[model samples]
Target: MTLQFSATALFAHHGGFGINVNPFETNLINLIIVIGVLVWFLRGFLGGMLERRRQAILADLSDAEDRLTRATAELTRAQGDLAAAQQKAETIRRDGVARAAAVREESEKRTIEEMARLKEDAVADLNAEAARVSDLLRREAARQAIEKALASLPKKLDAAAQSRLIDQSIRNLGNA
Candidate 1:
Protein backbone atom coordinates (compact mmCIF):
# COMPACT_ATOMS: atom_id res chain seq x y z
CA MET A 1 0.00 0.00 0.00
CA THR A 2 0.99 3.62 -0.37
CA LEU A 3 0.94 4.12 3.43
CA GLN A 4 3.48 1.24 3.91
CA PHE A 5 5.74 2.61 1.14
CA SER A 6 5.64 6.16 2.58
CA ALA A 7 6.34 4.92 6.14
CA THR A 8 9.24 2.75 4.87
CA ALA A 9 10.69 5.68 2.89
CA LEU A 10 10.40 7.98 5.85
CA PHE A 11 12.22 5.49 8.17
CA ALA A 12 14.92 4.79 5.59
CA HIS A 13 15.64 8.54 5.30
CA HIS A 14 15.92 9.00 9.06
CA GLY A 15 19.31 10.52 10.14
CA GLY A 16 20.97 11.97 13.24
CA PHE A 17 20.67 15.65 14.26
CA GLY A 18 24.37 16.34 13.64
CA ILE A 19 23.98 19.80 15.21
CA ASN A 20 21.28 20.79 12.74
CA VAL A 21 18.32 22.64 14.37
CA ASN A 22 16.16 22.37 11.26
CA PRO A 23 12.75 20.82 12.32
CA PHE A 24 11.57 20.63 8.61
CA GLU A 25 13.94 17.81 7.75
CA THR A 26 12.94 15.40 4.94
CA ASN A 27 12.17 12.38 7.20
CA LEU A 28 10.22 14.41 9.79
CA ILE A 29 8.16 16.10 7.05
CA ASN A 30 7.44 12.75 5.47
CA LEU A 31 6.35 11.26 8.83
CA ILE A 32 4.09 14.27 9.54
CA ILE A 33 2.47 14.03 6.11
CA VAL A 34 1.84 10.28 6.52
CA ILE A 35 0.29 10.69 10.00
CA GLY A 36 -1.94 13.58 8.84
CA VAL A 37 -3.25 11.54 5.89
CA LEU A 38 -4.01 8.47 8.08
CA VAL A 39 -5.95 10.62 10.57
CA TRP A 40 -8.02 12.21 7.81
CA PHE A 41 -8.92 8.83 6.34
CA LEU A 42 -9.77 6.90 9.64
CA ARG A 43 -11.38 9.78 11.64
CA GLY A 44 -14.95 9.13 10.47
CA PHE A 45 -14.81 5.35 10.98
CA LEU A 46 -13.20 5.49 14.44
CA GLY A 47 -15.46 8.36 15.54
CA GLY A 48 -18.58 6.47 14.44
CA MET A 49 -17.47 3.26 16.20
CA LEU A 50 -16.70 5.14 19.41
CA GLU A 51 -20.04 6.96 19.29
CA ARG A 52 -21.97 3.67 18.87
CA ARG A 53 -20.08 2.14 21.76
CA ARG A 54 -20.87 5.16 23.95
CA GLN A 55 -24.60 4.96 23.04
CA ALA A 56 -24.69 1.26 23.90
CA ILE A 57 -23.01 1.94 27.24
CA LEU A 58 -25.50 4.73 27.96
CA ALA A 59 -28.41 2.42 27.11
CA ASP A 60 -27.03 -0.25 29.42
CA LEU A 61 -26.61 2.28 32.23
CA SER A 62 -30.17 3.51 31.73
CA ASP A 63 -31.51 -0.04 31.84
CA ALA A 64 -29.56 -0.75 35.02
CA GLU A 65 -30.98 2.42 36.64
CA ASP A 66 -34.55 1.37 35.72
CA ARG A 67 -33.97 -2.09 37.17
CA LEU A 68 -32.64 -0.59 40.36
CA THR A 69 -35.71 1.61 40.69
CA ARG A 70 -38.06 -1.32 40.16
CA ALA A 71 -36.14 -3.39 42.69
CA THR A 72 -36.36 -0.59 45.24
CA ALA A 73 -40.11 -0.32 44.76
CA GLU A 74 -40.52 -4.07 45.13
CA LEU A 75 -38.49 -4.07 48.31
CA THR A 76 -40.61 -1.28 49.77
CA ARG A 77 -43.81 -3.06 48.84
CA ALA A 78 -42.53 -6.28 50.35
CA GLN A 79 -41.67 -4.51 53.56
CA GLY A 80 -45.17 -3.06 53.76
CA ASP A 81 -46.70 -6.46 53.14
CA LEU A 82 -44.55 -7.96 55.88
CA ALA A 83 -45.61 -5.28 58.30
CA ALA A 84 -49.27 -5.88 57.48
CA ALA A 85 -48.86 -9.59 57.93
CA GLN A 86 -47.22 -9.07 61.29
CA GLN A 87 -50.04 -6.84 62.39
CA LYS A 88 -52.58 -9.39 61.21
CA ALA A 89 -50.78 -12.15 63.06
CA GLU A 90 -50.72 -10.06 66.19
CA THR A 91 -54.44 -9.43 65.88
CA ILE A 92 -55.13 -13.11 65.43
CA ARG A 93 -53.04 -13.93 68.47
CA ARG A 94 -54.85 -11.36 70.53
CA ASP A 95 -58.20 -12.65 69.41
CA GLY A 96 -57.20 -16.21 70.22
CA VAL A 97 -56.08 -15.17 73.69
CA ALA A 98 -59.32 -13.32 74.31
CA ARG A 99 -61.38 -16.25 73.11
CA ALA A 100 -59.42 -18.63 75.30
CA ALA A 101 -59.94 -16.45 78.32
CA ALA A 102 -63.63 -16.21 77.63
CA VAL A 103 -63.88 -19.97 77.23
CA ARG A 104 -61.96 -20.52 80.44
CA GLU A 105 -64.24 -18.17 82.33
CA GLU A 106 -67.29 -19.87 80.92
CA SER A 107 -65.95 -23.27 81.84
CA GLU A 108 -65.24 -22.14 85.38
CA LYS A 109 -68.75 -20.77 85.72
CA ARG A 110 -70.24 -24.00 84.42
CA THR A 111 -68.15 -26.03 86.85
CA ILE A 112 -69.24 -23.90 89.75
CA GLU A 113 -72.86 -24.21 88.76
CA GLU A 114 -72.57 -27.96 88.40
CA MET A 115 -70.97 -28.24 91.82
CA ALA A 116 -73.72 -26.15 93.38
CA ARG A 117 -76.39 -28.25 91.74
CA LEU A 118 -74.75 -31.43 92.98
CA LYS A 119 -74.46 -30.06 96.51
CA GLU A 120 -78.14 -29.09 96.51
CA ASP A 121 -79.12 -32.51 95.24
CA ALA A 122 -77.00 -34.18 97.91
CA VAL A 123 -78.59 -32.09 100.66
CA ALA A 124 -82.08 -32.83 99.40
CA ASP A 125 -81.31 -36.54 99.25
CA LEU A 126 -79.99 -36.50 102.82
CA ASN A 127 -83.15 -34.72 104.03
CA ALA A 128 -85.36 -37.26 102.28
CA GLU A 129 -83.36 -40.13 103.81
CA ALA A 130 -83.61 -38.58 107.29
CA ALA A 131 -87.39 -38.19 106.92
CA ARG A 132 -87.71 -41.84 105.90
CA VAL A 133 -85.63 -43.01 108.85
CA SER A 134 -87.68 -40.88 111.31
CA ASP A 135 -90.95 -42.31 109.93
CA LEU A 136 -89.65 -45.85 110.32
CA LEU A 137 -88.52 -45.23 113.90
CA ARG A 138 -91.90 -43.69 114.88
CA ARG A 139 -93.80 -46.65 113.42
CA GLU A 140 -91.57 -49.13 115.27
CA ALA A 141 -92.02 -47.27 118.57
CA ALA A 142 -95.82 -47.19 118.18
CA ARG A 143 -95.95 -50.92 117.41
CA GLN A 144 -93.74 -51.74 120.41
CA ALA A 145 -95.87 -49.61 122.75
CA ILE A 146 -99.05 -51.32 121.51
CA GLU A 147 -97.51 -54.77 122.03
CA LYS A 148 -96.43 -53.92 125.57
CA ALA A 149 -99.85 -52.53 126.42
CA LEU A 150 -101.56 -55.68 125.09
CA ALA A 151 -99.19 -57.97 127.07
CA SER A 152 -99.67 -56.12 130.41
CA LEU A 153 -103.42 -55.38 130.20
CA PRO A 154 -104.33 -59.04 130.27
CA LYS A 155 -102.13 -59.89 133.24
CA LYS A 156 -103.49 -56.91 135.25
CA LEU A 157 -107.21 -57.89 134.69
CA ASP A 158 -109.14 -60.06 137.20
CA ALA A 159 -112.15 -62.36 136.65
CA ALA A 160 -114.59 -59.89 138.37
CA ALA A 161 -113.13 -57.06 136.25
CA GLN A 162 -113.49 -59.13 133.09
CA SER A 163 -117.11 -59.94 133.90
CA ARG A 164 -117.86 -56.25 134.55
CA LEU A 165 -116.02 -55.33 131.25
CA ILE A 166 -118.22 -57.87 129.39
CA ASP A 167 -121.43 -56.47 130.92
CA GLN A 168 -120.43 -52.86 129.97
CA SER A 169 -119.54 -53.92 126.35
CA ILE A 170 -123.05 -55.64 126.03
CA ARG A 171 -124.82 -52.46 127.36
CA ASN A 172 -122.79 -50.19 124.91
CA LEU A 173 -123.77 -52.42 121.97
CA GLY A 174 -127.53 -52.31 122.91
CA ASN A 175 -127.41 -48.42 123.12
CA ALA A 176 -125.88 -48.19 119.61
Candidate 2:
Protein backbone atom coordinates (compact mmCIF):
# COMPACT_ATOMS: atom_id res chain seq x y z
CA MET A 1 0.00 0.00 0.00
CA THR A 2 1.12 3.57 -0.73
CA LEU A 3 1.45 6.05 2.19
CA GLN A 4 -0.96 8.99 1.81
CA PHE A 5 -2.48 11.73 3.95
CA SER A 6 -6.06 11.48 2.47
CA ALA A 7 -8.24 8.60 1.30
CA THR A 8 -9.02 10.27 -2.01
CA ALA A 9 -5.35 10.59 -2.77
CA LEU A 10 -4.86 6.91 -2.10
CA PHE A 11 -7.80 6.10 -4.39
CA ALA A 12 -6.09 7.64 -7.46
CA HIS A 13 -7.93 10.93 -7.02
CA HIS A 14 -11.11 9.49 -8.38
CA GLY A 15 -13.50 10.96 -5.75
CA GLY A 16 -14.29 14.54 -5.14
CA PHE A 17 -15.19 13.91 -1.38
CA GLY A 18 -14.72 10.95 0.94
CA ILE A 19 -16.62 9.67 3.99
CA ASN A 20 -15.57 11.46 7.27
CA VAL A 21 -14.71 9.40 10.28
CA ASN A 22 -16.54 9.82 13.69
CA PRO A 23 -14.34 10.83 16.61
CA PHE A 24 -16.13 8.64 19.18
CA GLU A 25 -16.19 5.39 17.22
CA THR A 26 -12.67 5.73 15.83
CA ASN A 27 -10.87 5.96 19.25
CA LEU A 28 -13.06 3.65 21.30
CA ILE A 29 -11.00 0.48 20.77
CA ASN A 30 -7.66 2.29 21.30
CA LEU A 31 -8.97 3.97 24.45
CA ILE A 32 -10.04 0.61 25.88
CA ILE A 33 -6.66 -0.95 25.17
CA VAL A 34 -4.62 1.93 26.69
CA ILE A 35 -6.85 2.24 29.75
CA GLY A 36 -6.68 -1.53 30.33
CA VAL A 37 -2.83 -1.52 30.41
CA LEU A 38 -2.75 1.52 32.71
CA VAL A 39 -5.22 -0.05 35.15
CA TRP A 40 -3.18 -3.25 35.21
CA PHE A 41 0.10 -1.43 36.02
CA LEU A 42 -1.37 0.83 38.71
CA ARG A 43 -3.33 -1.99 40.34
CA GLY A 44 -0.03 -3.62 41.43
CA PHE A 45 2.26 -0.68 42.32
CA LEU A 46 -0.16 1.82 43.88
CA GLY A 47 -2.31 -0.84 45.49
CA GLY A 48 0.76 -2.42 47.17
CA MET A 49 1.83 1.01 48.45
CA LEU A 50 -1.64 1.62 49.96
CA GLU A 51 -1.59 -1.81 51.54
CA ARG A 52 1.77 -1.15 53.18
CA ARG A 53 0.52 2.15 54.62
CA ARG A 54 -2.54 0.44 56.07
CA GLN A 55 -0.39 -2.26 57.65
CA ALA A 56 1.91 0.35 59.20
CA ILE A 57 -1.04 2.19 60.71
CA LEU A 58 -2.41 -1.03 62.12
CA ALA A 59 0.98 -1.90 63.66
CA ASP A 60 1.15 1.49 65.33
CA LEU A 61 -2.31 1.09 66.78
CA SER A 62 -1.45 -2.34 68.17
CA ASP A 63 1.75 -1.03 69.74
CA ALA A 64 -0.17 1.76 71.44
CA GLU A 65 -2.65 -0.72 72.85
CA ASP A 66 0.13 -2.91 74.24
CA ARG A 67 1.80 0.04 75.91
CA LEU A 68 -1.46 1.09 77.51
CA THR A 69 -2.00 -2.42 78.83
CA ARG A 70 1.46 -2.56 80.36
CA ALA A 71 1.00 0.81 81.99
CA THR A 72 -2.30 -0.22 83.54
CA ALA A 73 -0.75 -3.38 84.94
CA GLU A 74 2.13 -1.45 86.48
CA LEU A 75 -0.25 1.04 88.05
CA THR A 76 -2.29 -1.74 89.60
CA ARG A 77 0.82 -3.36 91.04
CA ALA A 78 1.99 -0.08 92.51
CA GLN A 79 -1.38 0.49 94.13
CA GLY A 80 -1.27 -2.96 95.72
CA ASP A 81 2.23 -2.28 97.06
CA LEU A 82 1.08 1.00 98.52
CA ALA A 83 -1.78 -0.69 100.27
CA ALA A 84 0.53 -3.29 101.74
CA ALA A 85 2.90 -0.63 102.97
CA GLN A 86 0.05 1.23 104.61
CA GLN A 87 -1.09 -1.92 106.37
CA LYS A 88 2.41 -2.59 107.63
CA ALA A 89 2.70 0.93 108.96
CA GLU A 90 -0.58 0.64 110.78
CA THR A 91 0.47 -2.63 112.34
CA ILE A 92 3.72 -1.15 113.52
CA ARG A 93 1.89 1.79 115.02
CA ARG A 94 -0.48 -0.48 116.87
CA ASP A 95 2.35 -2.59 118.20
CA GLY A 96 4.23 0.46 119.37
CA VAL A 97 1.18 1.75 121.17
CA ALA A 98 0.68 -1.60 122.84
CA ARG A 99 4.29 -1.74 123.96
CA ALA A 100 4.05 1.74 125.38
CA ALA A 101 0.94 0.86 127.30
CA ALA A 102 2.57 -2.23 128.68
CA VAL A 103 5.57 -0.26 129.81
CA ARG A 104 3.37 2.29 131.57
CA GLU A 105 1.43 -0.40 133.30
CA GLU A 106 4.57 -2.11 134.48
CA SER A 107 5.94 1.12 135.87
CA GLU A 108 2.73 1.85 137.70
CA LYS A 109 2.64 -1.62 139.20
CA ARG A 110 6.22 -1.35 140.40
CA THR A 111 5.48 2.00 141.95
CA ILE A 112 2.51 0.65 143.81
CA GLU A 113 4.45 -2.32 145.11
CA GLU A 114 7.24 -0.10 146.34
CA MET A 115 4.77 2.21 148.10
CA ALA A 116 3.10 -0.69 149.85
CA ARG A 117 6.42 -2.04 151.04
CA LEU A 118 7.39 1.40 152.35
CA LYS A 119 4.11 1.71 154.22
CA GLU A 120 4.62 -1.68 155.90
CA ASP A 121 8.15 -0.73 156.99
CA ALA A 122 6.87 2.56 158.40
CA VAL A 123 4.17 0.75 160.42
CA ALA A 124 6.69 -1.71 161.85
CA ASP A 125 9.02 1.14 162.86
CA LEU A 126 6.11 2.95 164.52
CA ASN A 127 5.15 -0.16 166.52
CA ALA A 128 8.74 -0.64 167.70
CA GLU A 129 9.05 3.02 168.73
CA ALA A 130 5.73 2.85 170.61
CA ALA A 131 6.89 -0.24 172.50
CA ARG A 132 10.18 1.42 173.37
CA VAL A 133 8.40 4.57 174.65
CA SER A 134 5.94 2.57 176.73
CA ASP A 135 8.71 0.53 178.35
CA LEU A 136 10.63 3.72 179.16
CA LEU A 137 7.54 5.32 180.72
CA ARG A 138 6.86 2.24 182.87
CA ARG A 139 10.45 2.10 184.12
CA GLU A 140 10.35 5.85 184.93
CA ALA A 141 7.08 5.45 186.84
CA ALA A 142 8.48 2.54 188.88
CA ARG A 143 11.61 4.49 189.72
CA GLN A 144 9.55 7.51 190.82
CA ALA A 145 7.35 5.36 193.06
CA ILE A 146 10.39 3.77 194.69
CA GLU A 147 12.03 7.14 195.30
CA LYS A 148 8.82 8.59 196.83
CA ALA A 149 8.47 5.64 199.21
CA LEU A 150 12.11 5.87 200.24
CA ALA A 151 11.91 9.64 200.85
CA SER A 152 8.72 9.31 202.98
CA LEU A 153 10.41 6.83 205.32
CA PRO A 154 11.30 8.60 208.67
CA LYS A 155 15.04 9.33 209.18
CA LYS A 156 14.67 8.79 212.90
CA LEU A 157 13.62 5.16 212.72
CA ASP A 158 16.31 2.98 214.38
CA ALA A 159 17.60 -0.09 212.52
CA ALA A 160 16.13 -2.49 215.15
CA ALA A 161 12.68 -0.77 215.07
CA GLN A 162 12.68 -0.64 211.25
CA SER A 163 13.59 -4.31 211.01
CA ARG A 164 10.93 -5.31 213.49
CA LEU A 165 8.25 -3.20 211.72
CA ILE A 166 9.23 -4.55 208.22
CA ASP A 167 9.05 -8.15 209.59
CA GLN A 168 5.68 -7.62 211.26
CA SER A 169 4.20 -5.89 208.13
CA ILE A 170 5.50 -8.70 205.87
CA ARG A 171 3.85 -11.31 208.13
CA ASN A 172 0.49 -9.48 208.16
CA LEU A 173 0.49 -8.81 204.33
CA GLY A 174 1.32 -12.48 203.68
CA ASN A 175 -1.55 -13.69 205.90
CA ALA A 176 -4.05 -11.30 204.25
TM-scores, one per candidate: 0.68, 0.58
Q: Output candidate 1 Cα RMSD.
A: 7.6
User: How big is the RMSD of model 2?
Assistant: 9.6
Give all candidates' CA lDDT scores: 0.80, 0.80
Off by over 4 Å in 1: 1-25, 146-176
lDDT of 1: 0.80
For model 2, the run of ten residues with the poorest summed lDDT: 1-10
lDDT of 2 by residue, 1-176 (tens): 32225564635554566543544434655678899999999999989999999999999999999999999999999999999999999999999999999999999999999999999999999999999999889778756864564466547577787677667656854774
**Candidate 1, run of 10 with poorest lDDT:** 16-25
Residue 152 lDDT in model 1? 71
Residue 20, model 2, lDDT: 38
